[model samples]
Target chain A: MSIRQIIDWAIEDSRSQMTGTIVSPFYEYSDYGGHWVWACDVDLGENLGVLRCVPVAANNRELIYAEQGRAVTLSRLNNGKWVITGLAKSLNSTVHYIFMSFTDDTYQVLRKQLRGYIIRPLTYGELGTLVVPYGYGVLPYGAQGKFDAEGNFLEIVETY
Target chain B: MRNISAALENIILGGGTRRPDYKVYAWDPAEATISEVVSANGILDDPAPVDLTPYVSDVSWSDRQLTFALVDPAGLFHPDFGELRHCLKDGAILRLLEGDETVPEVDWAITFTGQVHGQIGWKQSRSTGQITSRLTVFGRGETQAYKRRKITSQEYTVGTDIGIALYDICKTFLGLTGKEMRIPFTLGRQFKHKTNQLAQVTPWDGVCSLLKVVCYQPFFDGEGKLSYVNKSLHRPAARLFEDGDRIKELEVPECSQDTVNKVTVTFLDSQLERVDGPYQKLGQAQVTTGFFSMHETLETWWSEDRKQRADGTSMKVIKSVNSGILPVGSEHYTQLDEFHGQIEVEISVWVPILATVMIAEYLAAAFIPDDVIVLGFGASEGITIPVGRIIQAQAMIGILLIMMSIGSAQYEVWGTPYDFAYLEKKSVAVEDGLDYWLENNLDIKNDFIGTHDQADIIAMTELSWQKCLSMPRKVSVADDPRLEVGDIIGLPDGRKLVISALSKNIKRGEIPTLLIEGCKVLTA
Candidate 1:
């Protein structure tokens, strides 16, 4: 019913192909209403790599790779490799499984739709583990996915 | 000495005196000849010390005199002589001796004579002149000096005109000098007297003019002339101020007792009427209304009839009245226009008259403490009919009924209407007959025909009708016996009277009628 619910449903549906599970839900900071970012660890059974994803809105997704103390950009040549850049915490020595998820709405519409969903009844401690993860990757390979609960690929919606 | 003489000459040429306060003499030796052979008889030709002293007596200088002898006949060797001869040549000089070996006690005299020689054969051009002068010399002693002494002398002459000019220059110079000294001085005193006099005079003239305009005097017979009376007499010490400072103190003359008495009479007649009489009447009226229902009734009536018709007739009757008299289906028709034309002039005049009476009654009701009411209706068919009033006749009957109810209640409570007279007296009362009619007819009543008493119904109806009436009533007691019977005889229903014996005992006087209608009705 709400944008957050839609994002959660998309993330949950994408978990089958995802190599990692969500370790933390989206943490919010005020930037145009509010911005949400999350990090997760993916297994990537064949080789260990990292994936970082920033979801600005339902459709806007940026895939990154987990690196030493940062999330670095992943080139098309290194597709499916996760390189972390501008991470608040260090990911240098230990290998992490990164996951990314996105929905298909604009930030404004998404915010308006998720107003009630964002202010859920969950306490601070419970919300830490309740978040869902979709795409996953390793350090050399970045993962990407079309996040949608009803199988509709995320699409950019433009407003004047 | 020669330089000194030259300097003296220069000084004299420079317009100053070259001589001191003493005398000077010039000498020449050329005029004298040595007579050495004259003493040939004197012993040996060697000119034995022939004691020339005897000749010295004639040549010696005395005290206060000086003599010089010239030895050379030329150059600087010139001698001083007492006289110079004209025959002497310019280069001639003789030895000259001067002596002052004389007694100091005697004043000495010196004489010098100089004769001018004319140029050869120029006697026609030359004037004969001789210089002879005497000098009285006084000193401690005299001397013959061969030594040269330098002397300098100077002389100056001052004319009166030049001295005056110098004095003027000095005066001007002194004046400038005094200015340069920068001494403080008083220039002149301020001339305030003229300004002050003008100031006082103008204001004085203004004050006099103001007094002439504002003051009055009352003349008396056989008395001395009286000054103008000051109207500010009560406040004599009043002062006027300019810019918050007192500028003038007003003096008010004392008013005579007679004048004060007259003023008191005038004040009592005019000003005191407003303060005392009206206020007392208002106070008394307020008290009566506070305990009575007079104003409530008056207000209700005025508000209801403010824009309505005067005679309280319905629209149908009013139109009928305007149409005059007409019979049904009569060919001899009375058209409304004709009927109105016939009555228009009379109605116009009569309406104003009735309106004047009504206005007078309203003014009396508003300001006077006497009950006065305007009955807006007149009886039409002698059935005590009130047809043409704006308010229903029954409504006026209601005011009377209310008043009678109050009166009877007061009588029952206090034993007499007079006992509550203070509570009943009012200046104005307006009754809206409509409100009573509506209330009595439309309002629900709980009790209905429970008591079958005819007298009670009559009494209640009488009281109710009195309460609804709007006519004025005066309270008084009957005073005459014969008039009582006459009053009963004038009643329209007198033949139907039941209590004749009791009616005979009633006193007669002109008390206010209690009927709500315009006409007065008698009752026995």
Candidate 2:
């Protein structure tokens, strides 16, 4: 049986007290089943998170922003890892978007190291680093971020 | 008051974090095995907890009844329409446990233990869509079976120990084991042996007769064991409650108008030797017939006791009949005609003395021709014999008397005397105190009472209780499983009362409450 649901439950339980927008992992991955997983990271501002999908067969990635502000949480099935769902909105589109670095064996290994953003491999074998998705232009305390020239997000400074 | 632990007390007082819960188990006494009927934690294999709501337990000095509803959505408890229907067997014991989840089950207090009393049934709520199975259980010792079952015909001799006799009855008639009873060694009463002791009563009445002889009463203790205790003994008060002590309500009812102000006990004196009536005229009847036959009946004032008689002789029919005709002095040639016919008769009567019947029959015949008539009496066609002269032929005839046996009581063969040979000596005891006098008198008739001293003791003891029964007091308080009947408790007014009845209702998420009723205890 997959422990991915258990991890998802842990994350949901841990995030119950969190009020700000959550910049969850946006990297699209195919689960044990053929279903595609979506990116759930959203902005806490008036704008919403962008829905992005990258099919294994399609060469180009698609992106579409949410129609209205939405909240996100992770859910899972017995077939695979986790699915990011928007509360009451549909934003199915294609575009390059931000994502978290943690997943599977790689995330398990990086969790034990220095507590900071770490680089990890994407589904298409492209390299990406985890982004805090906060303090973007025209948004305060929202989880929206812009990437650098090499498609790398700037490391967020920890105030704690 | 009822020996509850400190932890349980804390929970009841709202000082403990563990919530109070209840569990009920169905126990088979025959197999000595127990199965969970319902509990707060549910069954071992099944995780769904059984609903125990609308629970009511009413316990009194003479009875203990428990009623509760188990919400059965799956129909597990339905008797007629369910996949896993449970048919509770007769005499199946239901044990109630009151405890919290934090405490081990073994440490839970068994508030009640009773047998299923044949009231189990299921009902569906139309509004709530809930199917509930209701069960009613009666305490084992207080089951109506004892009051309904009659003890077999038996006899107890003089000096027979009442305690031993009660033990035998509970074991043999009631089918109770030694562990379920607490019989005293001797009840301080013995058979007087004057009037033969006979057991022709129900088991409950039998026990009552034996115990009342010693001034005791039968009750099932809190643990569901039979106990015979004397209420006259002064026991220490269990607890004292003041005006503000967890007491929700209190009331004292006025004395009833029918309260007994005087008690008169009348019984037979068994000490005096037996005495017979003056010659005791048994019965008499007359018969007159012309055809040498006659029939008549004699009504008796008292029954004829053949086995035991006041004169120490077997019952003998002694009677005299007047033929009402002068005997003609004549030789063989001129004798009245000898009538040739047989007499047949039957007589039925009731006798209150011996509680038995005595019947005697006589048959006589004579040979004479009906052609010749030479006697100076009635006409030849209507000759009367036994009461008038019989002119059947040329000969005269005289009737002869024959005797038969008498009938006695039904249990005469069992050797238990159904009737006392001596006349009963009435003994009366009166108690009419001016302070609480209402002129309501009580007349008690007890066959077991043999002496005037015993009669006085019984009357005075009964009067003492009748005086206090008028002042009934009721109180409502937070539920305490420890409270029991016969407990002497102090009231807010400082008067001591003996609990006679109590009722309690248990529900989840609700604090149970108790309603108690008692009678004031009169000080000596």
Q: Candidate 1 on A7-86: residue-level lDDT in tens?
A: 64576444432222222223433333464444333222112232334222222233322211121222221333342222
Query: Listing candidates in order, what is each one's chain A TM-score?
Result: 0.18, 0.23
Question: Stretches of candidate 2 above 4 Å error?
Answer: A1-160, B1-19, B28-63, B81-84, B87-91, B100-103, B125-128, B194-198, B242-244, B254-257, B272-429, B433-439, B508-511
- The models' CA-based lDDT, in order, is 0.20, 0.47
Across B1-524, the per-residue lDDT of candidate 1 in tens digits comes to 00122333333234432222112222222433112221122111332222212111112122122232222222221123312322233322111111122212111111111221221111111253422221222121111110122222121122112222222222232211221111112111111111111122222232222222122211100001111222212121111112332212222223221100000000000001100000000000001111133222101111121221111111111122123221111011111220010011112233334335555544444443333344456634333332334233434443433333221110000000000000000011111222321222111111111111311222222322222121212212111111111012122222111111111111112111111111122121
Error of model 2, residue A56, in angstroms:
99
lDDT of 2 by residue, A1-160 (tens): 1253455346644552211122333456664577775433333221122223312222212222221122233343344333333221111111111111221111111111111121111211112224224323322232334333254555342210
Model 2 TM-score? Answer: 0.49
Please report how far candidate 2 places residue B211 from its true position, in Å: 1.6
Model 1: runs farther than 4 Å from truth? A1-160, B1-449, B452-456, B467-469, B473-479, B482-519, B522-524
DockQ of each: 0.00, 0.00
Report per-prediction Cα RMSD to one decimal: 66.1, 45.8
TM-score of each predicted structure versus truth: 0.08, 0.49
- Standalone chain B TM-score for every prediction: 0.09, 0.61
